[model samples]
Target chain A: MTIKENIFENLRLELRRGCLTLAVLAQLRQEHYGYTLRKALAERGLEIDESTLYPLLRRLEAQGLLSSEWREEDKRNKRFYRLSGDGEGIFVQLLKEWRAINASIDNIL
Target chain B: MDLLDRYLQAVKKHLPWQRQDDIIAELKANLEAQLEDKEAALGHPLTAAEAEDWLKQLGHPIQVAARYQPQRSMIGPALFPFYLYVLKVAFLWATVIWTIVAVVQIAAQTPSELTVLAAVLRVPGMLMTTAAWVTLIFAIIEFVAARCPGKFPMLAPPAAHWTPGDLPPLGQQLSGGRKPRSFAHALTEVIFGFLFLVWWLLVPRHPYLLIGPGVLYWHASPFQLAPFSVLFYWWVVGVNVVQLAWRSADLIRGSWPRPRTAQTIVVSAIGLIPLGLLLSVPDHAYVLLRNPALDQARYSAALTSINLSIQWSAVILCAISVLELLWGIGRLSLDRYRKHAAAMR
Candidate 1:
């Protein structure tokens, strides 16, 4: 890649990094398995790679921000996820912070 | 289904053993789900090439598995800056000390080419040993820090006490006080300084390097450097040690900071002291013992010519040293004035 494109890719990744976490947390408010959650987000135009999404779900569950359980779905065992009580609280605060940032950026622009 | 199983098995290899089965099961479900969805859209089973293409888009299995593993570093980001700083300072000091020792050895006696080569070869081994020790120490620090975060004040973040006032002054940032030396300039100095050091060490064993074909004439005749000039040779080597060390440090640091620029003036001034002593050795005193191995008159004539050249060379060197000192002082003064002006602004 050209240097400019490489720089843009790096910056784009950085910009998306925090937002990706917020989006995942927001999406996990209702129960959804890994594959369905990814598909749900992709259908809404936020296309995350399966590799990135699966690991992130585990990390969030580990951090007590999300809860998970293995259940048979459509004749296959799939790990389902949803925001925990702590996750719900955190997600609400994060959504507030996100909206504040968006409003500030809009004002600045 | 076979291709999908192979991919999940490949990913399973790279995952942590405890989580391998659990992670692979989930991943397998996800991939099969994706394949099913793709088949549903096309209303047909995927061919082998179609399956391969889908797996390729997901990336290599190792890459896919790697994301599942926790990120690890020998020296994590928190301690990395200190680790690097320690290594640089340690290497710089080591290089400086080594150069000093090498100069002293050469001054004491001219070493053979093989001996010089052996000494040169030892340097890489010394640097590697130093690096290994430094890295091991930092790795231990990283281990400790990982287990007990904020235990070491050095590694702890200054979050609680930090304020806007801790920021650097606007003027200092804008002016960029004492700009770093260019890599090109430092590299050139290092290359030439190293070459000069090698040449200087070689000169004693092979006088021909200095005087060229004139060494043959001097050898055939009986004129050699006077006793004082012989001592002066060692003195010159000693003075050059300081220059070599300073330049080497500058090359390593990629900057001539205030202390180094000050050392430059001091070194140049010290250099002139020897040249003054050299000038005091009397004009005819540069060459001693004129034995007539060839033609007596011709040898004497050549001796007188060589002696005059030596005297003139000393004078020229003395002038150059003085100019170097003056230039250093001027540059230092200008740097200070610029800094002062920037601060005031």
Candidate 2:
């Protein structure tokens, strides 16, 4: 690839990183297991791989932003996740900040 | 099902030990769900080749497992800068001291080519040992800092508690092109200076410590310090003791304030006295203890060569000390002038 293409790819990944976190947190408000949550995000135009999505779920749960429990679904044990009370409050604050940033960027553009 | 199990096992092999079972179970469920969805769309189960391709797309097992594990290093980001600083300072001092010792060895005894080669060959091993020990120390600090953060409060980041008021004043900030002494630099100096002080004190009894290990083959000891060198030894020890104390205090305080900078300049200036005395020692008259293994003529020649070497070493040391003193004074003066100008403004 050309240097410009490589540079653009890096910058794009950088831009997507925060958005990916926000998307994951926003989607985890309702209970969903890793595979379903990944499909839901992909359907909404954020096509995250299992490698990225599953680790992200684990990390969010570790941070206490999401809670999880394993339950039998379709005769197989699946870890279901949803946002916690603290996560809800933090999500609201983050959304507010994100929106403010979006407006500033829109105006600049 | 077999392929999926194998894939999970591959990932499990690379995962953190305590979390391996938990992570693999979760991963297996996700992979199976994805496979079922794909099979449903295709109206048939995936073949082994198809399963292999799918797993390959997800990533290498190690790479996938790595994403699940928290990123880690022997020395974490918080301590890495200090680790690098310690290494740089150590290697710098080692190089300087090694060069001085090599020069002294060549001039003093004029050892055989094989002896010189043997000493030179030891350099890499010595450097590697130094680096390994420094890394091990930093790794231990990193481990303790991670395991018990509250007990190691110095390593704890003040991200949440800090305010804009905690920042240095506009012109006083390090970013404003005014370089100052660093805490790591001061700490390194104190540690290395103390080590040198101990080695210097031991050198009288263990003269071979200054000379290379090749001297062990000699039937009797072949060198002695000139009488003046014996007197100048105390001066060296006194100067080093003062330096070690000052640098230790600087390390503890974590900043080089004006008064401490002034103290360093004074200490450095005083250090020049010993170097001057070292330079004035008589050349040929400075004799070494006669080695029974060598003839009288060889002994006399070696003594003359050794004394001349000592004088030259003194000259080099004196030059370095003079430059260091001048630099310290100039830096102190510049800092004072800047502070005065800032006050006037």
Candidate 3:
């Protein structure tokens, strides 16, 4: 890629990075395993790569923002994740902040 | 399929070992789900090649594994610039000490103007050893920093403690207080070098310059400068010329040059020729006075003491010279290397 294109790609990734965490937490309010969650986000036009999604799940769980469990489904094991008590509170606050930012950006644009 | 297992195993290699199995299990379940979904869409089982292509979308093993790991760095980006700066500075000192060691060895063993090049030849080896050692040390620090984030606080920039108000005025630094040695230090070196060059060239004809304060007290009979061999004159001149050139360059460049590891090695080796010459001169060689103070016995004892003082003074000077040169090398190295390191950052 040209340098300008590379720079834009990097800047675009940085722009998306903070939003991805919020999107992941919002999706996990309803229970879903990794593949299903990725599909749900993709369906909403906000696809996250497996590499990014799985790690985000692990980090969120580690931080007590999400809870996860392993269980058998269709004779195969799946690890399902959903928002924890703390995650639910934080998600609500973050959602409010996100909307404020969106409104600010919309006004500026 | 074997391909699926292999991809998981590749990822497993990079995962934190304590939690590796759990992460692998979770990862395996996710990948299996992906494969199942793909198969359902195609209405068929995937071939090995298709399965491999499916795994490729996950990312490389290193990249995938790194996500699970904390952002691993030997030295984090914050400390890496500093760590590399320290190493580059260390390389300068290493090259310098090696240079001195080479010169001293040659001056002591061969004492010829010709052997200066041999001493010069040994500099790269010194720099290489130093560079290796400095790198190894930073690597160890990096290992510690990556494994335990809180340890090695020096690895962090001052921003950890800094308020925006702590910043200097607009004229102040982005990274403050890492500048080259002042022009005064270089100027002093140049002045001293010029003085010494004059002293060596003319101390033969005018003996008063040799006797610091006693010139008025003693009879003004001139003693010969015959004891100083011709090779000795050339060696001293060469040493002074180097100092003059180096200090002059520092003055001009406003810092030491990018360590031409090879050139620096040679220059440092040549430096020893003079230092060795100063040390090896016998205590009785500097008898700059011919006529005695009317008291012969007292005068002979006093002359002996004078020669002895010169020898002792030279010894002290040599020790001090070695230390100061090492320090000079350090400062010069730091100035040059910091610029280089900052550029990399």
Candidate 4:
């Protein structure tokens, strides 16, 4: 892409950044592994690549916003991630804030 | 194992050491799980194209990871104090180094015949050295500050902005203050005035020299010194008188106002005239072209004296510039503080 196009793309990406967390939380309502979460998000029209989704899950886990455990099935181990207690609280707060902001924007529009 | 591994490796390339292993493990687990889900959904083992397509949809690894962590601000809450501290240390170190190099260079050079070239060369070393020292000191402070974060509360997070309406009136701050003009202000003017007068008088005479042959000597022309010589002397007297007046005035008034900017500018201008003459006139050109009548030592001495005078003048100019710049900074800081205080009120 041209420099200007790249810059605009970056700005668009930044604007969409906040929604990514919501999308991650919404998809991980059930225990989902990193790859499964990415596919689910893509299917839901929030199309996150694996590279983006994996680290995010890790960070969310680190911040006590996600819980995860290694499970072995069919002789292969998979790390499954689910919402932590704190994650649930944060997700609810985020969802409320998002709704309020959306409504405010709707009013302004 | 193929394109997926390569893609994963490429993503890992961008991450720092501490998080790299964890990130890699997380990604591997996630990607493996994704591949399994895809296989289950399709009810068959996935083809390479299918896997590539899935990975492609995931976007670049770094971009994906970056979304999870917001970029740290360049002048962020965590780093600004450190940055300013580094800046100040660098400035201080640079100042010290420059002063040392300047003093040494001036001491070593052949003296008496003041040339513009000698003056110009002396400046950069002093400037660079001073800048380096200042930066070094600030950097050290910042380093210490990083360890003991609370020590510098003034430089902490949530940077404040100064606005015009927020400033306290300048007159109010200066009025009814007890301390007279600072010794620094008085000392600076006196020292500068003294140096200027001394350079002017001694430089022309080639004073403190072993008179030698093939040396060029310069005397200040009557026209250059005409009015200013008298005014320069009077200004020195005036500065002392003003210093005394301000001191006595402080006995009645609580505070004294800062030295007026106009006075500084005028004094600086007066100082520059001799400097301009020194630079514009080629004092040593004639020495190289014409043999002088004096003895070898006497002529060499004359040349040395002129060279030393020029070096000293250059140093003085540099010192003056530094002082003015510092004064400007002080003025700015005071203005900002007043504005901040007013805003709080």
Candidate 5:
């Protein structure tokens, strides 16, 4: 990509950051393993690139914003994450603000 | 072997250390189960590419890992204090300005000359108009403040809550986007800073500067009018200085992790410059000229210039103050929304 195009792409990337949190919070209501979660988000019309999402999950988990566990059965295993108490509380608030802002935008538009 | 390792690594990259280990173990078990299931379904062993394709179809590893995390709010608990401070400042300023206006109107009129009832009625009307204007301005500020990036917490309520099955892994959720600072904040500081500096410089000196020619040519007329000029200059200077200092301190405190007491002292000290200037200047000065009596025309002309200057300063200061106050209110509202959002999750 040209340098100017790369700069614009980066700028656009930054603008979309807020929505990623909202999209992630919305999908994590169920206990899905990592690969499953990505598929779910993609299905829902939000496609998060893997390179970015992997680091984010670790960071969120580290911040005490998420919980996870491994399940083993029939000689097979997969890891799963679930919303922590704090995470759940935060998710609800963000949803409200999003809705409010969305409504305001809708009205304006 | 290559496919299995690649798949495992991809999934591992997304998981936390403890979670990663757990997930790897679980996936190993689950893949074994799936292999057994495939053996039964296909009536034969599955190919390595088919297994890799199955895992790829399921989605990226990070996306699946994120699903286990709790939903996070758009707004969080971190910004509550800042919000409350803005709210209090807006309320106090609005209350004080209207209250003074109300009391002055009531005090200036004589009970015998004017009915107390009429004066009482006017106060509420004035207050209503003042409040309406304040609310209207604050609403706009609140709307603008919400769009401000990085001024609020990362998590808040209604936005955070998502179903476990639907949620992306924490890594996936955090991976995108950056927000930039708002222009309104910068504009406010610049406008206020300029007004404050100008107001500070225009303050008439205490013994008063001799206008027209000095003693060498035309008799140096040291124009000394009512002590009001000194008081007026000092008053404007004092208000501007206090406001400037207050705003500067707020900006500094907001940006830096400094002690609140130190910030307050610095702000107050900056405000005291104008007050000191007012106090040190002589209240009255002799009109050192050929004619000792005041020239009403010339005196009025001087008074007019001073009055015009003071009026312009007041207008600028008032405009900036009102805008600042509204911006403060907007900041509070945005904070409240964030807290509410965080709480909802």
Candidate 6:
């Protein structure tokens, strides 16, 4: 890639990284397994891949923001995930901050 | 082997050993489910080609495995700057230690061009080796920290606790954080040496270059440069050229050199050879200036005293070079054995 394109791609990723975490937490309020969650997020126009989603889920679980358990369904064991109580609190706080920023940007633009 | 099983096996190898079975189970379930969905979309069981395409879309085995492996590194993003800082400190110390070793090894013997040349050539390789070892050590430390950060007090501190007091004092910032430093005094030597070279080379051809009209005094008549004196003059130019190149490099870099003692001591040591050669004049050495303004007999007598004074100055210079060489050796030897000495004490 040209230097300019490389720079913008990196900045775009940085801008979206925080938003992606917030969106992931919000979706996890109701239980969803990894594949179905990815599809659900993709359906809502925020298409996260399996590699990124799986790791994010693991990290959030480790951070006590999400809890997961393996369950058998359709003759296969799948890890189901949902937001923890702490995750709900953080998601609400993040949503408020995101809306404030969005309103500020809306005013300026 | 079944393609799906083989693919899962490859991915499994790269995952953390303790967590491998569980992770693989989850991954296997995910992949098989994905494959079943693909076959359902096509309204048939998957062909080998369809399964291969599906596996390829997941990602390369290593890339997929790496994401599941705790997102850790031999050197992680949080500790990377500190690792670089450690490497920088190691590099500085190594450069200094090696340069001293080179100077002492060069000086405590008959100074030769080849020895000095070898010393200069050895530096870049030694520096690179220092850097490599420093990186390896930091990487190992990083690995340990990732596994058990509580083991080392230095690496265990939480990021939130960091304050300005925890930061080190700013060191000599230069062109490159890793290297590239120059010294002002060294730069002065380069400029002075270059100008001196211009004058030294020019003066023999045109006596008026430096002294100008002062040459007209004593009814001056030029003498032929002696064969031995030619060697001495050439040696002087060679020494000056070395100084110019060496110091100019330091100047361009904008920071002082390592083992500064080496630069001073080696320059003094190499210089003594030509001075000794010049002082060992075989016959009447004052013929360079005829001095017709004085009576012929008295002029010869005065020239004798002048040559004697030159010899005295050469002796003094020889003494200084010997002392400087000895001083450099003493420091280098002391430094080499300092750890041993402290333990003995």
Best by DockQ: 2
Which has the better lDDT: candidate 3, or candidate 5? 3
Ranked candidates, highest TM-score first: 1, 6, 2, 3, 4, 5
Ranking by lDDT: 1, 2, 6, 3, 4, 5
DockQ of 6: 0.48
- After aligning candidate 1 to the native by TM-score, how far in Å is the CA of A48 from where it should be? 2.5
Highest lDDT: which candidate?
A: 1
By summed lDDT, the worst window of 10 consecutive residues in model 4 chain A runs over: A47-56
The predicted structure with the larger lDDT, 1 or 2, is 1
Candidate 1 structure quality by residue, lDDT tens digits, B3-106:
98998889999999999999999988887898899999999999999999989999998999989877779988866877888899888778778867876675
TM-score top scorer: 1
Query: Which pairs clash in the backbone of model 1?
Result: none
**Against the unseen true structure, what C-alpha lDDT does each candidate score?**
0.81, 0.77, 0.72, 0.60, 0.55, 0.73
What are the per-residue Cα lDDT tens digits for candidate 1 across A18-78? 8999999998888999899999999889999998999999888888999999999899999
For all predictions, the C-alpha RMSD in Å is 5.5, 9.7, 14.1, 12.8, 21.6, 12.2
Off by over 4 Å in 3: A89-104, B111-118, B142-156, B161-226, B229-345
| Docking quality tier of model 3 | medium
TM-score of chain A of each: 0.97, 0.95, 0.97, 0.91, 0.83, 0.97
* Clashing pairs in model 3, backbone N/Cα/C closer than 3 A: B74-B142, B99-B268, B103-B269, B120-B266
Worst 10 residues of 6 chain B by lDDT: B172-181
Of candidates 6 and 1, the better by DockQ: 1
DockQ of 5: 0.14
Ranking by DockQ: 2, 1, 3, 4, 6, 5
Instruction: Give the range where candidate 5 chain B is weakest over 10 consecutive residues by summed lDDT.
Output: B172-181
Candidate 3 total steric clashes? 4
Candidate 4 residues lying further than 4 Å off, grouped into runs, are B2-25, B33-78, B81-108, B111-155, B158-345
